[model samples]
Target chain A: MAITVIPRGDVPLGQEHEFFKFVCPPTFGGGPVDAQPATIKFARKLDVMADLPLPAGVKTYNGGNSLRLWLIADPNDSSSNGATFPAKTIRTKKGDVVWVDTGFSFNTHTIHWHGIEPTPMNDGVGHTSFEVSGNFTYQFATNTAGTYIYHCHKNTVLHFIMGLYGLFVVDPPQGPKFAAANAPGAFGFDPVNFSVPIDVEAAWVPGEFDSIWNDLGHNAFMQKCDQNDPAGAGTFTQNGFLNRFRPDIVHITGVVSVPGNPITDPRVSVAAKTNQNILVRLVHAGYTVQEYTLGLDATVIGEDGHPLGVPPFDKYSFPFVIPANTPFRLTSARRYDLLLNSPNAGVFPFQVKFMDWINGTVYQTAQTTVTVV
Target chain B: MKRRDFVKVGLAGMSAVVVGSMEIPPLFRCVARAANLAFDMSFTEALVEMIDKTQVYHWLFSADAGFATTGPSLPGPTIIATYGDKITINFTNNLPQPHGFRIVGTSIGTGVIPNVNKAPANKFTLTFTAPPPGTYLYIDPFYEPVNRILGLHGAFISLPKGGNTPYGGKTTPNVQQLFNDLGSTPQFPGDPWLPPPANRSLIWLFHQVDPWFNARAQAGIFINPDTLKAKFLPRYFLISGKTGAFASDVPNISIVGNIGEPHLIRILNAGLANHSPHLHANHFYVLSKNLVVQNNVLNIDTFTVGPLDTVDWLVPMIRPPDIPGLKSTPLRQLIPHELTTVLYTLQSPLMYPMHCHMEMSQTAAGGNYPQGLITHMIFTGDVDKVPFPV
Candidate 1:
């Protein structure tokens, strides 16, 4: 079957205008190394394109700093810029063919659907035979029911940093039945057509940025520079751009400016009925390592793009519940979908800490507020 | 209206003005475009003058027909090319010793046959197709240590083909911007993110000179190559053949371009040691690494370049109208910004420093720093006049 495709655009967000102001405090963890309140910094900010409205009957989300989880414009729209960072999210049911129009005019790239085992021809990679150019479409089928990731495989080092990836979730066939069977404890009555027994769902993607690296990588001057030339290599040797790994900021959902300050409100909150089970999908879309700890008990129901079940695929996959206060680790491009068992009548925050994989220094911290009322 | 207010309103109003059949203003129409389509270099031995008012013997290359090596622009010539174009160079070696030329991107085999007893062949020739545009280097590989130190190195660049031509062997439309990943529209010529194209580019050829080596070579002393490497101590640092605290201070070394234009900067490290070229007040996009055009590059200020490394970059000659802290000083606040659109325009020309981040190379013979391998990029606006258009 021909897969349905949609188009979206990703516009850069920077300090291009004078109206916007940067409100983050400058420091490693938004705190001073010497322990003093850093003076608030300000600059005219760049315009961040608004996310697309949710499609009819589809879930809506902002992955990073107003980045939409779906197509921003119609595919037939001729006036669009034709470039989208974190290409439009793909939401479908298991056993369905999904075609994504991943073509971009800005650069050469391939979309590697992280978890799907598509045929070599359908898998998007530059070295492989599946690379697409101009306005070609990427077609594949969802054989597994789970949450997965898709990112550019071309120039993996630089293209991925430019935000060329998105989340792809394939729901089970009996989603409503599963939700109805596992009704919220707060509501004594079983609900009809409930989706996976969840009262609320949220997505958290951890990301980092080094403006200098991003800017330099996107520069046109070096586009043609001879990389093999011994005397022409451009290397950064400063604390800010050190060894090409000094990240300016560790951000959540893309709300923070790089090489600047951290914000006071770096949290996302989701409201839940008292005793409701909340499903939180965590995806690590950056190069750094992340550790997410929960203050309330939550069970790991799925990993990568497959739900834990059955003999071949279900071994040690499901029913693995982590007690509150324990941390789970996630490497780059990894995903974990957790079903949280909300505690008593109070707000429980899910704490996440990001750190460098090489060293053990905390780069950033974020909390997702789970308000159980 | 205040002076600043009038200036802003006047410029904004001029955008809408149509002189009968004219769409753009006369001032903008006068803007010039620069392109370096060809190059000619000759390798010869001559007495080299230092920036610190000193003189030494040196073997160098220059575009000058006389093969003049003792001047402000001493390090040979930069070959600026665009994508899809074929470039040919006829090199005449005036030095007593035999030398050959090898460029990175071009398919020139190493021909390091040294001239023994003044051979009949005193010239070399090279022609090649340039593409996958990027910064490259031309060097004398035969006598790597001796000849290179004597300043026989320069930069080569393959610019993006102009007027709608695809680059890097891709079927996509011609790159409107410098890099394929930058944006849809071309950034330099005319764009909201930058001012009008001033039509200029820049190249910084970095090198180091050991006064002792030059003095010995000048006096016809047969210096051992191994000994030279073991006792290597550089005194004078150079950028584009001139040693100065700032690029503007050195004649023919200062890089000047029109404000608001995206200028291409090719920085080549021709020394034995590594040096980090840092741009103050602005950051540039590194367009390539080695000789390959990168799909996605980085924007950096200080880039550590080792010996023989070439870094190609695109620097937009624009800055914030007024820095948040420097608004009080009239000298610092010159650019104009629209209150409603929040867009910035390069109103008055400005000068920014480009120097080595190594800190020590900025000095002459280990004296005060900021004298060697340092220069300035002049963004010519109404406030400053440009001596060299490109």
Candidate 2:
């Protein structure tokens, strides 16, 4: 099976233009936009290629497809930028209702707001509801301010690996500057001036790509979706390679992290001034369990979009700080918001060890530095 | 019907319904006034039937006095102790190989017991003071994941000293009152079926079984612990050693509660692979992870539980989030009224699934979808009043 880009003519008339405009409206200025039940349009891109040029070899595959939402609106800009591996991050504010308009396109796909709890109809689990064969608007309100994710829930195992997901962050009403302030005891940061309490936010979504699975066609395992063969009784001639997952390439937040080289992707390898609070939103977007070891002491304040130690929740639990060098683990779909403040200036490496699920053996280790100037 | 009768009806004709037997009594007894408690446990082997009727060999921890009887189960037995109580387990290894017991998240008896080969030596006594008030995993530390995964793991719950509340001072809403407020009377009035407010808890011990590993162990094939040569492809996923339709029927796996009440679900990922347990009907408040109380409690429908990680969730048994109500958000309006208000009435007793979000865990025997790591959270009310199917 080879990668085939859907011709522009094949798309529904005026969809690419209208939806693209809705995604990146003329009013979008890189800041948080009011979701006042906003209609955020997204069109599926199939057979999108991601080429990683590593020192050892140049690994390439169209295993990735972005939910061309608000981040990338230009239909002509189809280049596989490292930043666009997983669809660009969708940022919104609390109390905002986001109507994700997944426009009609190729094979059936549903965008599931991973951690957010919306109505079942909008939840995007095709088995529970109906798969979006045509245009469907998933509606959900951002009730909580925390880090989240959105991905295609159709044939999730394959669709997720195909890179049809991205970070979905809901900021507090005070916006991005106050994102870290949501944590208990988070003070001394000035969100207005963005100076004394400079917040260096970095989203690290570490994922692994199995080149074999990536090379397969988009409908490689469509037979499994046969409704008639609910019990999997029907004999499908193709080998069930979906069960066998062996990842060869590892990437950190879309940028491929070569074994011996420093990940210089500005989005991942972040820069911060001394005394600046570095808030790292770590989302484990891979199949394997990930163990993250940070060079600086991190006060973990949130998990799965809930700020730790915040009111109502604080009645039952409180946030605890993890000492530097201590490793913490996260499974797929787990998000942890860590607030790190460095008093001294130095280059600190944040390492992620992707291990086999059965045994805690590091299959791959990807590193991104937190350069505190 | 009485609670016991309800249990009998719910578990009728199910061969795997081991509740009300020796395996379940200890889990519900949260208030242990005794200063010290002693249990006679044996490490034995058994053939447990899966949902697909596949009889799988397992090494389990049985709460039997001796290994003379074949009473061992897939998940051993739940050991519950009040905070500050001394727990003494007279553990006997009935299996051919040496097995050891150690509690994760507790301070006492942290070391693995030495190999018990001879008669007197095989029967080892382990005494440990119940650490803090939280949930813990008691497993055979021998060979690490190999021994633990083979069914030698169980839940060790340390109840709060003063009361049923997990944190001692906190209090949950009255379940019976909540049900009454929702216009339903208790099916078994004055019956001691429901735990006291804030004391209702369920243990979900998530585990996956690899048949090849079990077969190898049964054949006496030595598996190197440091370097596992066999690829781990678990075919069966279990919640407290139960799966598929059988899991939801088990009183221990499926959560049954009244409207507006809270049920604390103590979830332990005993499997090697990570699991994301997704709950329907209502989102749960993540109270703590790995015995540490979470400062930022998140109300989420799905949360991740990594290998060997223990998470405590407080399930607020309210109306389903998608249900149309006066407080429905703007997004809720998008859902058709038939699917919301018209379909499910407030008096309806609804049942929703609590399944693993990890796509592969939804399968058993490799490709049997919806046959693994699935259970239910049922709200108790007047079921006949419900006009539509839930």
Candidate 3:
């Protein structure tokens, strides 16, 4: 039976809407992920892997503001021939629309989305319009299709550093082949609802911030003066998807000292337990397009947020495209989710490279890992 | 004629014309112009002397004493007055250790004051006739650690200077001059209506610690004793007070944690040592430093809390969950209570620093005292914002 991959969506809410309930079943002590079945089940609790809660709060959007995108899934992704799997990929259109409901306090943001052409009002920018803080909805649609980035276009001292940025992808030239009567039976599906991004931007990798000399321009920020984050991961572990609510400060005065912050953010451990084989809708949100190598050797079953014909991430030059300043973000909370199936446990690492044709290195964060069962 | 003859003629003609009339700037003229703009903004620390070493202490008055670094060292007397009456302090010292002060308020009016090892005792005592209504501090070069420590640091008690007048900044000036007044004539300054760290009609002392470099380095460098051994290594980590400020509390001084009520603790690191001093819960702000305090500092849960750092915290602020609608389960409030307060503000509950900044300093003979290297901005009664309902 062909399988599928995407973020388990619509994390159901409790009647009382307790803050803790909405939070990822906290790492270790966190209680539960109230998401619907798909979002709630923790990658099949197995003893081989430690059970961890997923940091949570799915993307919410307001009405009037809407998002449109293609949802593609993969049955057998190439990156996972080595990984145990019952996985699938979800794909989006050349121009997809996602919405943002300024329904909550943290939702107040200006959308700096990449890859598509959005109507001025739908596009998330303060200069163009007002901020969608509470129940106000903002809509956006992507026209420039390629891997891109999105973030709150607000006056952020460091919003992205506060873990605000997300990667988005558009339609790749090649995509998944949905089952048709000509060949297969109606395929079963995995319950991931949203398009999740799995861009391996070192910031989420499980490794200590050993420094990436490859990102030449940033070498100065990584000089030998050390804080032994490697010898011990301490309470801080760089891994998995970040939190949609809180933000982790990434740099201070240009220094790349991971764990060099409010010490340990509980989000990492939280994200570890809740979600699984979720779509890592990859996008290029940085100034330069990156050569994001999942340092953990993840198989690429999908490209540009879409499942490919045969997933090996075989499309080398099919660059994850993000135009310089295009506002290609979601209108109705629509996001491009990547398809993944990581049966392997523990934090899987990844290295991000800003492949700027200028013969250089990719700036990186402490290696982040996505713990899976 | 040769072309050479023509060239010589043109040159001679141009030279004669120029010499007779044209007045263009010369290279040296440009150099001189630049030189005129070049200003070597020098500074210096205060220096006290016994002349005979027989005098118990030499009194300093701001009016007579030049408390700036770019001019004289022991230039004059103390600028003295009552607690509430405002005053101006002017100084000059063309040496090093740019002078600074450690008073409280808006971080303005910080000129070159001295922080020298040989500071005048009482730093040229400006005995306030009385104490101000609130806690106040005054030092030279108001922004750093070295200048605020050692002998340069002093306290100001602005009590009812005139008929027990309370703190209304608008009260009439006091007539009584506390201890020493350099003179009745005002020193070099203007009005006190300006912002903080600057007060007209105030006292100024110099907290000078010679070898300012050591204290300055402590704030920046991390000493890994594991990597460097004593006597065998050249990197001396000792700053201000020569030795043991971090290892030992100020000798003979017993600092109290919490009195009867919520206490307000003000820790100033105007010395040379980079101190990762932690207190029990209570967020703090680095009020003034670098001679000017910027508004850059907001509510800080825990900071490096280093040299030249000034933190003012309220001890009695309530722990949350004490009010209605807010979750106040003991476990829930534990972390914030522990990390955010003065007692174990940084631990996991009340959340104190699991590991202090400079992580290395958190240890003594390889073990943490938790209390020794730690402090508390303790609260006493009626915790202010406890969010849980009865």
Candidate 4:
């Protein structure tokens, strides 16, 4: 079993610690390396300083959205190769041991692996399990082959929006069974053998941030909990804790060129030869509902880490064809792995659409594209 | 994808095509086949004070939905019907503000309206096809965030057509099961693949209210939606409108049930926050969620019920009498692991404290902890004093 130890932190990690203390100032139960960091971030910082330079093609919203994430450092790699936000794409074979060290410099955070059935102790929910303050090692064996989500469990309403998340993909071991199932020779079935496919692959982690929630330290908004209408709008008391969750910017793969700037939003790229299959893993870490439409015909091979139509789970899982125009809806923290077969060389965009939860209305679309030549 | 486009694409067609691949058992399986039944109901506005004396200006359903009398109750009573029954509720809104109702589950009817006040003081005759027996929710869809919190929701249950037994198949006909009979063993002795049968079924419609909103609305003050969003902290957590908001009243807390009979605890979280309900002595088996039976019922000491989620568990009082159908020896002898029996069968009836694991929910409005959302499962000295109302 391969043991992969991944450390979670942010780029210019040192600056994030400074910023966290500055906004949450020690007075309001926030400071450098405070014990109860998750619940004690700055109350309200309408304007925050961007101590770190913006990544190429990335912009900020609301005095700059401050939460920059990175999953860096492979303990196995002695070299200086380390963590970066939209943390390095985690790829592993089934049965490999993944030892995730959640060493957050500021605030408390727990890593909840969406759709992965880890023990309750390993299930990183703040209230359910102990939240990691400084550093804690979470060890688990990847048993299922599918695209899964990983995000901070502390103060889910806020922490998830603050951009502490990534995707975890476990690949099934290749074998005779896998080869037969994904045989390209099967007529009209250029199946991208997900079990050990000889094809290109890309992982799309679709998420958004509420500019306001990310700008202020968690403590600032939490400070307003159960208080009178500070906003003075007066409809009723504000539930700062209730997750009003109005995000201004949406991006893919943790590369937000600018908050509220979806125009230059990034899309994952993959190349495959004509008639070759490309595997696309669509995963969600954001809090709202997302619907995705594949530009080309694709077969859904797995969902939530289970092989479609496999025994026992066949009662639930089944391989369904996504007709060219049909869309697959994903609630918060859902994953779908699809194999896209390209008959012609061109760009195939997966239109990831967002909706307003209060009213079932499609509001926006974020695109992730794959090009085959 | 646009909403209209999504609807056009095949919301209804998708389910039909998917079900063709597999055979899902009929929702509720009962032995006693019954004919379709219908009922009429209405909503009336009332200023009722909760257990903590916090007055809420809310809409309540009158006990008799029989077309004439209107007396609103806290958690409008449960609407019980048999599978394949047709429930037609004539919900007349008598409040100053607009109100409407919708029954969720099954495709019997389209009972949703975007706005209840589109027609001033309207009366909506909603229809529902009740099949696939399970617990369902009927809430005020309009301003649900506001109206539901103001106490405008109720429970709806559809029993299998003719069977007193839930999920009837393997066991004897006298045994009434809640869902399908997966069949049971001496170890389970109740529902197959589930816990022992409960003699009494209790519904705990969990809800919470922000006292500040209740006070503001009661004073006839206008509340701004944005401001309301800013101060939305729910302090008063309740189970069926009990659990006083003060620690001193803990002794007189509402009773969950008495010992000797396994209690089917139906827990529904209508509030915004997730509730981790922790039972004291006896761990329960989560039999079903919403109304869908699980492949294998899970045994848990504390489980979370998220907002708008429903969970049903059998809080077994003891090792039930091993019956003929369980296919195993009667569990007359206690094993070392059977601690649930030792604690419950103590010489004197005991009160086991059960509360929310979130900790904050058990507090008073002013941040006093251990005041709200806490109760006890009472074990009576004599089995005759079974606490629940049949």
Candidate 5:
């Protein structure tokens, strides 16, 4: 565990207590553990560093200084401060019965839940089971309700690009209501009537940060192999430059975005009002190939966590529409959801881009804004 | 290669088989059978062989002499068609440079088809008309993606004109026989793999090989699409073109099936990274992505086919939800009653694996860990003892 650089301008620029936010703790909040089984915990937080704020002629890769671990949902308080970089947003509900726990501490992580489907020793998948080192829990039973993602399956490509993920969502048990004031909230899954009212939710996610593997450390190119050495523990190799993925830096839910500008981060912009609705969600936590582009007219309805046209999958699938200034892509860990609404009111411009998995080359783009009113 | 023997070896000169008891007068038997097809192909330059055997070179696609008798093929065959057929193709350019072709989500030849000379005057053709039904890729759109990652590309499919469901029209609702009757249950019996008048349809495609960018495009050199995102290094991860351990010992990249059938795979991420495959024991049903459809399909076990996407899934070869099921009430009271009485008396053929959670495509030349883009989904009760090469 030794690669802690932090010396480029001795880390300064916009610290904001290194982006705080922990809150939840009431043994996982929401009165009476939302009726019975809940658990939650989290607690991993190693090394850590957030800062972010780029946008004015954006140039990252260690300057927007990331290097993270997070997960801290108030793991027994100690003044909380897990320093978020995208390790919050869990929000359960639909059927509930969670567990999660996690814990860890130094090097062995796990927490998968990417599209949930529990059971494989609670499916955190560290070689199909076991990797938590100190804690584990994970139980599961959220039963469908869209948009998920929860990273850190051990060295999952440098711990999900060194920021062990977040955003698991779920909702639908008529909880987190949205559309304030004019009433109506609910959100996702409306196969004719389960909920989907919305009134602005957002989410985005969109990652990408390759500050040379964020200054390498947590077992960067792991090695240890012998099997009676004869130059063949599968032909041993060193470094191999951790499969070269040069993303200078591009954020979007963790903010940063300065390639072409416009991420006036009011939590990545959105506002709303015209005809209300909204929703977004997205996900694609970077490994490249993002695309996006929207400007309204979305509709997708759900994916990666179900809810599309509903019923026995609406005979075979439905919730389509992707009109306005189109584009659409998403790759690594893909998740969609969409929904938007805008009948008349302005602003729009979603964007994203980030490409380069190989040929589709739009290095970085980001942008944000939705406004409407 | 049994996707109907790779569509009878990439459509043997468009073998016009019509036969649904061909009397077709009863009001054009609900009309829908355009059929025309054609073929030829070529764009050669081979070398192939890499399931650790090495070799390399590439620039594929070759059915040539009016189809069948194939040769150069990394991902260069498959084609098929139906939804209003018509097609064509022809091609030629035996490699040395200029290429073309296109296809991606069709609309009558959608441009390219160029070929710029190599064999005499090279040749070209293309044509079109098979849009609607879904899945399409065809590539070699010349240089961008280095002539489709130095191996051209393939898969066109289309289907659905009673090709037993994969997309609407023809009274829809087959949903592959309702997901092969949820894995043909009587506590799971076989029968599910349907498509093309009932069975066999897999086409995975997904490729990777970056042998130093195909040995600098096999010596002609020239790359520089701005240093190809910093010297693109792939190290072999394929599917149709098979990779390490012969990518699950072939049958079109490891996918046997029997215990309650359920196959219909069709993945197609003509490589450039971003995979996320994962498919341990069961959980599959995604049904459509690039060709649209997919409204809340779900049942996932990891899905994220990126670069030039196109997923389709169905996999439900049933049974393995951590086994344990003879009759266990209340989700077996949440497991662990001595491991659900020892996994409820185990059974069937099993196998599993289906790798690529993007952990560096499960490694290959950069340390052969599971030999890149791994495979295997057997489940066999006896898919002819799971070996297919004929």
Candidate 6:
């Protein structure tokens, strides 16, 4: 059985930009310096990104500034985790549990389950509190199917600065990972359907440091010099918003670090030999308006996480652009169940594109090189 | 000491055009005669007679040349003394603002501290017994933030006790021999290649300043007292306490031409960043800094110093005194050329500078102050090396 995938691309930037001041030495609380994970128990405190018509001109190119948050997680905080829905390319059978554990200070992550509504508790941000630093489980019941996304909601700036968001899909049948575990006489009332996992969660970001360290206030000296003399008109700048969202590379593997791993790594370094082709599921997790179009530039064996009416196993190309600000449902996080016919013997390089406003710097992210012996 | 050595001219009714381009500016020169070489220094205290008294704004600079003792444009005066001699430097502040000077390292013998502007000028006395042989800088921390901008400094050269030269290396009859053994940069062409013939010396001071604005960011700060208004916003820079065409008044370093002798360049830095100071036509070796350096390989062009960093470059001998290029100048043509022709001198000898490195630091903000930064190392054409281009 294959898992069904969806792309809940249309997201709303309700109350897009926010600023919070944090004084050092804790003017209010000389309290604990390291608060493992901050809690978002109040619904009013968290902002939602969902279906909304953004300014047409504001494409991925003008991926503006980022919101910064300092998250210190306690030893246990899975309850504090937020959730998302799925991407538009997964199809599955049934009875498979897709689990996503929220980590802290590591990456920016927040989850949203767009299509499958399970009340606000499963919404992730202000709805449920899995409490980060601790572990929580989301079971993708083989009953429903849809698309969604997951990302860091609290202290988002820090998370996004590092890259932590993804897409997911769900199918009514059991996933492939669980199929091998099924026993010989396991079929009872209605045969149980399992699904497969197609891993695709990547992010591309370049000019990482310049955007992080820029401080707008420090440019005073430069400004003063320019005022006294007219020599430098536009060539130099003294001040600007510090560490504003200005990424040059938009990576696909979800992970920005080199050498992505197929299993744990959004930095996926694949582990396989020739004659083996694996399917992959992708998710969208950024604030800027995205028209995510995924074209295999190869073949189409599956759609929406499952086999098409008559699967075109032959080499082909299909491009699907995910709308901006998508959500991730828990069930879709598992994987997209697509059959791989013939695998490429060597690792092939892949990539993705993102836009930054005007001086749209850092636009392309390196793709994972799939390795097959 | 016999006479015919120096011709001191009062800077009045005399002005010369910038003789050359940045690439080849006139090189003014000066020679330090051998006799009465010891610096005449004294520590005295004075009370400001009135509130309207002239203000003392002295700019200061320092250099750290590893271990060897060298001279400084501080040519102002040497705080001379024998090893073991007790010395006291008393500073009297005639102007406003707080001031203090503390030597970097040791308390006495080794380091020195300047006068404090806070205490009435008559109150403090810097006392200490001179220590081991070495050249060190005595800094004035007085209103330190600003005093350095206005120069207030001198050199501390202690003479060797018994029968020894004030210098540390093995004894030699002249300063050149001390330079040869345990020295820094060697000699090259022109007035640079050979050592000065032990003559009376003068300082070639170099420094920087801003014509307008201070911490307050005020505009057109430097003004004329008579009109109590800024005459012109000076975007100009300076060396040896002057700027513009007027800067020519500052003396140059020169010597009687000796084709094979080397000369000294005592360079200093005041505040104002950006400096890639260079000398034209000649390449020099840096020998004695605050002290001399070991493993002295010559050829030093441009070295950097932030604000008050001091450095020394050795001018070497390139041509023999018989070269016709050097024969025309009055000292050589009007006068007779002789051996050690490198001892060239103008009516009076002086040392000009290569030029300041802070690109625009040499010019005024807009094209306002026409007299950009320039100085010359004057020498009488009679000296030995190839005659300097007219």
Q: Which model scores highest in DockQ?
A: 2
Ten residues in a row with the worst lDDT in model 6 chain B? Answer: B46-55
- Using TM-score as the measure, name the better of candidate 5 and candidate 6: 6
Name the best candidate (by lDDT): 2
Residues A1-373 of candidate 1: C-alpha lDDT, one tens digit per residue: 3211111111112211100110010111111111112122111101123343322222212222332221122243343433233444556676565555444444344566666753223344332232344444444556556676666544344445556566676776665223212223323323343235556766677666544444443221211212232111122111222223335445555434222322233334567776676777777766555687777777666655545432222221223567888887765655667776665778666666765533335666756666778
> lDDT of model 5 at residue B49?
55
**What TM-score do all the candidates reach, one by one?**
0.42, 0.72, 0.26, 0.56, 0.32, 0.34
TM-score of chain A of each: 0.65, 0.78, 0.32, 0.69, 0.34, 0.40
Per-residue C-alpha lDDT of model 4 across residues A1-373, encoded as one tens digit per residue: 2211111111121222222221121211111110111211111111111223455444456455244432333444444333444544466566555655555545555666655543323445432234565566554555556666666644444555555555676666662123112323323443454343536666677776655555555433232212222111221222433334445566667654343333234346566688775667767656556677777887766655555543322222246678876886665554566767777888766677765433334545676556678
True contacts kept of 2: 0.16
For all candidates, the clash counts are: 48, 8, 167, 48, 1, 218
Per-residue lDDT over B1-390 for candidate 1, one digit per residue giving the tens place of the 0 to 100 score: 222332222233212233222222111111111342334556766565564345666776656432212221345555545666666666666666778787755665346544634555665556666655666777776656777777677665555554321234432221223433232332223222221222334456777877788888767676677776656667777776665532332223444444444455667777765665655434455555566444433333455566777876666543322122232323223213211111121212334456654434644544423335676654443212222111
Steric clash pairs (candidate 2): A301-A308, A307-B296, A308-B295, A308-B296, A309-B295, A309-B296, A318-B295, A319-B295
Show where candidate 6 strays beyond 4 Å.
A1-373, B1-84, B103-122, B130-137, B142-144, B154-166, B170-178, B181-197, B200-202, B211-236, B248-261, B272-274, B290-292, B320-353, B364-373, B382-390
Reference contacts reproduced by model 3: 0.00
lDDT string for model 5 (A53-136, tens) is 445555455454333333433354454465476777777766666665656556565666666654444555443234555565
Indicate the TM-score of model 4. 0.56
The interface root-mean-square deviation of each model, in the order shown, is 22.7, 15.2, 30.0, 20.6, 18.3, 37.8
- Candidate ranking under TM-score, highest first, comes to 2, 4, 1, 6, 5, 3
For candidate 1, what is the DockQ? 0.02
C-alpha RMSD for every candidate: 22.7, 11.2, 28.6, 16.2, 26.1, 31.0
The residue-level lDDT of candidate 3 at A257 comes to: 25
Stretches of candidate 3 exceeding 4 Å from the true structure: A1-373, B1-262, B277-280, B285-297, B304-306, B309-311, B314-316, B320-356, B364-368, B377-381, B384-390
Clashing pairs in 5: A308-B296
